[model samples]
Target: MSKTKNSFNHFAWEYFEGLEKTQKGNTLIRKKGRLELICSYIGNEPISEIGSPRMLEVLLDIQANSLNKAGKPTDKAERCAGIASDVFIYAGARGFCSSNPAALIKSQLAKSSYGHRPAITHPKDFAKLLRAIETIVGDPNTINSLRLLALLFVRNGDLRRMRWADVELATGRWQLKPLKGQGKVNMVKDQVVPLPDQAVAILHKQQKINGHTEYVFFSQTAKKHQIISENTANKRLKDLGYQNIHCAHGFRATAKTLLQEQLKYPLVLVEMALGHTTKDPNGTAYGRFEYIDDRSDMMQKWADYLDALREGRDTTEFRADAQNKADSTAQLKALIDQLGEDKVLELLKNKD
Candidate 1:
């Protein structure tokens, strides 16, 4: 293909098509939307002719017009700038453009001033939210779906696109594909979430309703898709009067806080459980399934703690148990460092 024939529109379409192949479910929809916004503002000019000036114009236009979930006007200059940068980088790599002009003005884009997603960080507030989730009237699937989101605390996109084939109920495991742009090439692997018994029960109930469909939370009214809307869980929470106070994504913040502060789980383990990539002391990437047994135990304990909070039960015992487990893990690491793996194993075998 001639570089002159590769217009911005053509380049964008081809770029997003590549993204569709590599990315999963709703991720493509979002990238397509972003591409549309870029194309609409930047016109179908030749890819080589589009430079920093055209990119800045599009960024300014998006900043003045974009509206967030609440339909309030907000600046999305940063997001548009990012999309432009990526598109131009791809174009440059393919020899459509000599340089990535979008990257030149990326830092000039206005930063988003939106506050963090609201979460019930307080124990009393979280307890009340849990109670509200339990009693909220609607489709049983919707209710169960929200409950599972809270319990697992995974991203909304991942939760809605959950495939039944990825779940192993017998082993209480949910295998999650890496999000868009996160996988083997990125040195990230598929995340394996150790589902608690409560999470398993929720899945069982959901299975009864949506077993026929590939997605656990299937949308019957969707024209060509089986997965539920990305906004379904957030909308349900908003309906129950949690519009600003809580959202589907806020469950992550809630879990991060409670798991670390109240439960005393190590920060590294918590981040790994959240499917975030972390590095070791020597800058080596940790495996996705690292600390599987400990993570499973932590998840179950986290679920039990949530239940205790909901029922207004004492959590002192749970805290103690978590502390003891952390201590045991620390001691084992120290022993391993002092003695080789073979010696440690032999000592344990002799004790047994």
Candidate 2:
């Protein structure tokens, strides 16, 4: 190892390499963008020379200077601080720094509530959006991709990077590779998403068009056989008059809300279906595959529920089904409490 301290830019490159080793598919692209911003602000200075104050200045500069595609001011201080904090921690671990100063002043960074992504949480509004997606005149690939995002509720990056090889139509499962920031550190396992019948049907149609290539949403215009751009789906949504109301990422939030609040699935099941990490009561993170069966069932029901909403069918039946299951569970618990587990099991077996 060189005794000379590494520059911030050098450290960032190494850190990004570390991210690439662990993360998959478009995960580190955002981090690399943030690193570019940091490097632009600080130049190629020695990592040890910049402490917490300088880190704070860099973050504030990013916040005040960043602009969105719409040419409006956007705040990225929180994101910048997060990246710097991680970089400093990596440097500290490698003996190039004494402490992660970015962590110390992270809380003091600028906080803004200006750029919240819009989502349709209401069932009726979501139904209208689904109708719009179905009827929209655009690239067929873009439309189908948008529908898949709404139905499956995976991250936009995950959807864009989907591979046909990862999809098992017969088994109704899509084996998702870990995106840049998903799952625990150093535990990069493929996430198995249980595809609903509707989602699988969409995939079958997509296969007819793009089956020759690896990506499900492959775009001929894009470089290196990559799928469509990240903004393609959202741009379509905006063109459909959902600007600031619903974007591609909004689909995930929309699904998360409706599944729990409307369909009454357990929070854990919903989170698992979305491939998010949730901790148990002891503060330990749940295993990635802890609730596969329940998640599968929940995803199928969610797809069915979306279909009902799209057709403007009465959704009360979904709520009724959920209530019936809850009631059955409660009654079973009561019976077990009264008659004992063995007696209850015997009674159940007799009834069977």
Candidate 3:
């Protein structure tokens, strides 16, 4: 009989839950929630004591089990398999087991593209989400928090880490140090995102809330706390009859879709707005700040357009001062080395 830390025993899930904050631990949690649910089916058997054959049987059993709350039995098993596989990878890394029984279980998932796609509901659904937010604004802090998220479109993780010092009232920007990108990669990673007007509105209101707290969106769980779980905002959106489809992340997709499809802005502009390009050619190259001033207006206008769209208005009053004209003589080639190469290639390929 073998006994070990990840023995697949009764307390194994609890042990894994303890690892949720560190990088390795956090990676597990990213998919851990799903995995733990599968583990629950394994009962109190010690995984270390169980041989590969037994593990395989357990996996198949979970696959066939009916999780009533999960609607269809196959869907529950598919999720279970995915999480179980994640555990195997983590376990194998630590030499717990070499075989991954849960691996390739997704091959059994029903239909195409996991049978689920992002849902873009009718505009009223989005309006209802905003209205849900409206009802909460009476709680001054919640109002500020929602406004910050709407304006910045910061990932739920990043916003939760916001601090007051990051806010520059004069510039209407937030200078967050040590971003989520830093934790995910080994290279030079911290980034500065300039906050637009609507985001600043949060701080403008925050100043009135005792004004001395360190966090811009401090959680009520503790004094001077800066962290707000991603679920905090998500739960609020769900409670108000809005599905996840129309919440914080949808706003980001909204920004990307409108800027890319509707507005026809340059890709780099869109990427910059979304804070893309974090390494090597992407890193130093994006730092040129060549169009920072120009992007300020573009980003602000994008937010205004989202406001209009959410308002169910056919006519969107754009910030013309932002749209009227481009006053810069900057060339695309100067920004992206590839553009210059592409031009050369075009000339070479076509002789006059």
Kindly list the per-residue Cα lDDT of model 3 for residues 190-262, writing each as its tens digit. 4566666766665777777736777665657644344455667666666665564656556566556656656
Give the per-residue lDDT digits (tens) of candidate 1, residues 1-352. Answer: 2223578877777777788776755556766777788888664788888878877777867766775765554546676666777888888998878978778775776555566888888888999899988887867768888888888998887888899999999999988875742633542467889999999998899989998889999888766666777778888889889998999989999999988888888887888888877788998877867899999988998889889999999886566255777789899989999998899999999999
| Residue 258 displacement (Å), model 1 | 0.7
Q: In candidate 1, which residue ranges exceed 4 Å CA deviation?
A: 1-6, 67-75, 90-96, 180-189, 320-352
TM-score of each: 0.80, 0.77, 0.59
Candidate 2 per-residue C-alpha lDDT over 1-352 given as tens digits, one digit per residue, 9 for 90 to 100: 2223577777777788888887644446777888887778764788888887888777777766776665554557777777888888888889987877678776785445456689989999999999888888857789889989988888888898899988999989888765643545543345678888989999999999899999999999898547899889888888899998998889889988998788887787777767766777898877767777777788888888888999999886575266787789899999999999999999889999
Question: Which candidate ranks first by TM-score, i.e. highest?
Answer: 1
Between 1 and 3, whose TM-score is larger?
1
Evaluated against the true structure, the overall lDDT of model 1 is 0.81
> Given candidate 3, what's the lDDT at residue 112?
22
| Error of model 1, residue 15, in angstroms | 3.6
Q: What order do you get sorting by lDDT, best first?
A: 1, 2, 3
lDDT of every predicted structure (CA atoms) = 0.81, 0.80, 0.58
lDDT of 1 at 138: 64
Better of 2 and 3 by lDDT: 2
lDDT of 2 at 71: 55
Better candidate number, 1 or 2, judged by lDDT: 1
* Clashing pairs counted in every model: 0, 1, 1
How many residue pairs in model 3 have overlapping backbones? 1
